[model samples]
Target chain A: MALRREEILESARVLFNRWGTAHVSANRIASDAGVSPGNLYYWFPNKAAIIRALFAEWSAASTGVALAGLADSGDPGDALREFVHAAERQPAATARYAFFPRELFALLHADPELAAAYRRNFEAGVDAITTIAQAGIDAGLLIDPAPRANLRDVVVTAWIASECAPAFLEVIAEEPASGRGSGLAGAILRSLLTDEGAKALDERKGARGHEHRGIRAG
Target chain B: MALRREEILESARVLFNRWGTAHVSANRIASDAGVSPGNLYYWFPNKAAIIRALFAEWSAASTGVALAGLADSGDPGDALREFVHAAERQPAATARYAFFPRELFALLHADPELAAAYRRNFEAGVDAITTIAQAGIDAGLLIDPAPRANLRDVVVTAWIASECAPAFLEVIAEEPASGRGSGLAGAILRSLLTDEGAKALDERKGARGHEHRGIRAG
Candidate 1:
């Protein structure tokens, strides 16, 4: 007779993305999910908990999907290429995925617990990208002297920006590259990878990718 | 007596810093400023209008201040120092001043009048930055095959990123620099401004700054 935890989260995601975390109340979420507030609370202790759960779910899914794309491939750079192609289909979901700051503003200011959790989640993301970059370097894939801190920042930052740009460009229009994150990611990939790495990536789909060519020649 | 419009905007600035755009409503704004919704309505048509008014007010003040700091100096690049310093203090205002995407989303999508206004407003902002970049080139302070389009797009994109970063970072604390629109503004300034421009910019106090210098170096 009661809605499942999954149902509640699915409904909450819809509402949270549309209305915002601040405007959506527990009652509204439960109502949208076709459940009572008590049931929603049973699964998520509070709105903050719901948000945390949502972040954990999306983070695991996004990172897992991206990483999985890279796992089986022989060429780490190509794996990353495959990963980029996979991330493009879920534009709205990706856009929603990146819309945390509006909600985070109040939570981080008020709740130490939320802030710490947020810090850990993002650091993990950066580390994930760092690991991928390290692998590329070890395999003789990437260039520009693999600087750990900077490259990690670049990839993780790119992941977040790529997710946000769709909705953002839905309004501003000029910001989105035709390849979405792929082009930017490729540019970043080229920036950090070696000549062999670049060749491998360009030949990922067995074509000479032009992102590498677009870099200004000075 | 009704609350004065300037007083309302200034108070809204404080509220925005603390509560953000979503959590705080016209009702709270009216009450905080010791007026009624009706009184506030006389000054601002809606919550978004209040936000828009604040944007205009803050942009007018900050832009004028930054411009004056530049104009008084013979060297345009030197003036850009004031611009950078101006940026650090101004993030709080920038974050508060723009309507958060969630709030801006519907109006941007549906309201034709607001959409046109949005376009004009955005174009104006881009034009201002382009003009600054052009002036440096004209003075032989900047090196550019084409100053106007290049500088404007870079500035517009980066400023939007900076404007949007706090919200994005609030959600994704792991990547604070994700939406930093102006992150590349200085680099564009440096790359386009040849030796003469760099010399001029160097003369200004606090002219040179970089959060991730490596992002632009490659």
Candidate 2:
């Protein structure tokens, strides 16, 4: 199948989420996917390349998919709910999405081009969030109308890391994860929401059954 | 000379923050401290022992320091600020605290006891946050009295990680010189302060020589 490469990538992501990049060797990935490690190497040169691919793929789907669906919504509160619901759909898949965001953030330690690309995508998502937030204000649903620096990044980045539990790295004495938040997106949102926006989300309780109750938005 | 152990542990904490335990061999820590690795091993059996000492020492100090300070403060918001600020001061030293935490949650591939300890510490911190939150509600500073679940961990963990920006990790992709948001803790505090709290902070802006023009804290 033309999508075989992507499939391997997908499987690699699964293994990575479960085993981390270190333990889930290419040989293991190949075996899990019913291919040879040699075949895996034919596509990816080494462990680092596979990790890079996983990160790139996650960034593509996450920002693009959620923002695309949320773009048309006039109310930022509704848009945020849609996004949360989307994230909640797959506990495992979403876990995959949350899994490596720490390492992805850590790319700044050694690589500039990679960091720029990450910030660009992150900024793009933030822009979309800011736009929707503006809409909420114009629609009488949001409190503040201004775009604060790193507003979305500060919250969203932390939220993703929390969902991933990057703070749990000390047991293995790891880095980067310590540097990131456990997940404060929802709390940060609460601080920024309009009285109306907060009230609206408050009404959605017990609805949608999304399990990401932490992002209660209020 | 009696302070040697504390000094060794302190030096280890710094190296742990930048290099991570796996990357920082005993020699690196010894050299950084201007001591021999042989002396280091004499005090602690292995790096893991040193890791445990760091956690035990920090946990005891942090858990008691601010709680003692805020014991008489009726306002939970004030206590919460004290708590967060205390954490902000030792962001680097605390990296060792999060070293295993990073693995337990982010990687989810660490030893069981480490993960268990992480959960225990995390829950305790959550309890502390919730206690203050409840106090805030009782004091009439907070509107909603009920915390859905883990509101404290989600909020505090996110802020610290985003703000600390650990070494060897790419999580803080933005350039430090850019001076955006001033790490997650300050950003979160600014983002989540109650309207009243924001006003309190803003009232001092002129005298403090800091501007809060567009910063939303409701």
Q: Which structure among the candidates has the greatest DockQ?
A: 2
Off by over 4 Å in 2: A1-3, A73-81, A90-92, A97-116, A145-195, A198-218, B27-38, B57-69, B74-81, B84-117, B142-170, B175-183, B202-218
In lDDT terms, which candidate is top? 1
- Per-residue CA lDDT of model 2 for A1-218, tens digit only, reads 54667767878888876665656788888788777777788888876677777768767765764485365474466675565444434233445555464444343444565566666776677667566655656766544512322455444544444334433443334333123231233444444555666566666545556635534444
| Model 1 residue B74 CA deviation in Å | 13
What digit string (tens of lDDT, one per residue) describes model 1 on residues B37-151?
Answer: 8889998898778777665565565465345445535545544545555655655555555444324444454455555666666666556555666666677865543311234
Model 1: reference contacts kept, as a fraction: 0.05
lDDT of 1 by residue, A66-141 (tens): 5655564565665655554455444534555544533444455566776777567556655656666667767776
Q: Count the backbone clashes (under 3 Å) in each candidate.
A: 14, 35
Candidate with the greatest TM-score versus the true structure: 2
Residue B27's lDDT within candidate 1 is: 85
Interface RMSD of each: 7.3, 6.7
